[model samples]
Target: MAIRLDDITTDITLEIDEDVISIADFQKATDSFLGLVKELSRAVSGNADAASWQVKVYKGSVGVGVSPLSSGLDSLRIRNVMVSGLRALADGIRPGEFTDKAIEHSKSLASLFRKSNVDPNVRIWSQREESVRVGRSVAAGAEKLLAAVYEEDGSVDGILEKVDGHGKLQLVIYDVLNNHAVKCEFANEQLPQALASFQQRVEVVGRVRYRRDGMPVSIRATRIINYPSKPDIPTLTQMRALLSGSAST
Candidate 1:
């Protein structure tokens, strides 16, 4: 089954520091804004395609709100995440500092402003009338600080919150270090296992991909090891006694 949300609305406001705005500059700013939000959405919800957008450009700034493109898109969650993540960035909060949400400090969430060539240090606004002015600076530094994604043999354990997509099957794993959900793809052979393990804690063993800051983003699962539910888990003493009995035998 799938889930869909409706009429969800929120705003992302961008303040450009320019005396005379040209068409090219405007496009760049909007592009950067969209790219920033796209990364934020993907980091938060595993999807970045906002539905419909309404651009309301005020005298001093441009505020953007979006509509759904199709069913099952949570544009609201995307916007909320944009707010929280921007707050973290604007306040100079580094990843793993106080709290690390799905949106990492260097999650490429602000990597577009550098291309914008417009000064965003003046102001950026969220749905709650809050301002985030670090868009440009964040974009600039991220290029130098954030690492590239690479694959390696490893394991990552998290709750199998969801499985999505039609042709391309993906599983969403909610990592505990942060509520960040990592989306992993499995072969058709592994689909049954992934589907059966939904909502359970499972460790995916295979080639894993990580973001620049060492966050797992992709896991090409060779196997899915479902951890025993709490009720099914034996106590430490019980396991030890069982092991002792086996040794004696």
Candidate 2:
């Protein structure tokens, strides 16, 4: 004899045997069970106005009813049975494994959110889109010269430098794509002029030396010249469209 669980509206019917249950059936049941937990939580949170819901379980069958009723006794009985089923399911699924995976995924997402300065409370779909945009922006910034070491005479364009307290003109050039920074030293003769163009795009011609850690320790600038400011980057919507192979707005 085989036990069966059925939900007519969802068109779900599955055999409930420990040895015979397929992976697909298990996944489907897990999803359905989690959804039910969410619905129950919402009801408990006062988001649901229904008077009652019903759940039934027997030796060989299970059923659910999400309708309203005037009385609460049936609802209480249904809740008890649902809890028992959830406990059994939890034991079968070894929920600790899923919990561990969920924790790891959350940590990764939190790290991404921190790097992108995006709020985690944003809509999940919007967060996904924003994460992709952030990744592309980082990639675009990294492909620039700032991320690489140029031991030879090389020119880096569109960087802003500032003067330090020691009266030396210093700046940290960042590779947004690679999440790295290169410290640069401006020629003493260029300090006066570089300070004048503070926070504005400037071109630096130099021989660069990198540390063993792959960060540029210094750029020995031979000359400095003002460069044009960069144009505004595309908006998230435009980036998304571009990434999706559509015309960017």
Candidate 3:
């Protein structure tokens, strides 16, 4: 997402007077420089990956487990790096004032999450165009729940109204696990439980984030062993042939 600014027109440079040098004046100059750079970064080219960041889905399971990676430490690191850079630019500023500017810069970076539409401040997750387009097909499968909710009459309108109020879609995920026995033409395990688990795992209650192989991510029957609900017998047989030993039950 890097934007080349070589083609853009710009003519601006800041220089200080060679004479008068006071601690207060030096601090003022540093604050001015940092403020201007911050504003320019917001208005012109967006921040490099150096200033903005995101969380990646690490793992997921049903009644099993869910884990998220980084916990957003990467973004915090970026903020710290930016603050250090800002401090390096404050040559004659007092140490206290320089530290204050660093804190301010970090706060500015954190504020990017709330300004999803603005340049340099937008969040990768809250970008509506991308999510709506990419998640459209995947989200469609989850529509059954919405349809079920709609049967209550006010559910659809109410949900839409809530979304409008918050300006974000909401969702929830639930995991269900159970053991059952059944005979299938295609497989040995009962697939109704799998299907139920999938549908139950996906629910939209608020701003939703989607990730590949991430938590709340469900694997469908068609996705793994084909002809879901068919005898797991063939799959088991294939596994046994490949392993030449007992496989997980």
C-alpha TM-scores of all predictions: 0.50, 0.29, 0.17
Q: Worst lDDT window (10 residues) for model 1?
A: 1-10
Candidate 2 lands at a TM-score of 0.29
Q: How accurate is candidate 1 locally (lDDT)?
A: 0.59
Q: Report the lDDT tens digits of candidate 2 across residue range 24-48.
A: 5435444443354334433343335
CA lDDT scores, all candidates in order? 0.59, 0.41, 0.26
* Residue 225 lDDT in candidate 2: 79
lDDT for each residue of candidate 3 in 168-207, tens digit (9 for 90 to 100): 2122222333111111111124234334433222222222
State which candidate has the highest TM-score: 1
Model 1 / residue 4 / CA error / Å = 38
lDDT of 1 by residue, 70-110 (tens): 45456556555655555555454443322333233333334
Off by over 4 Å in 3: 1-12, 49-249
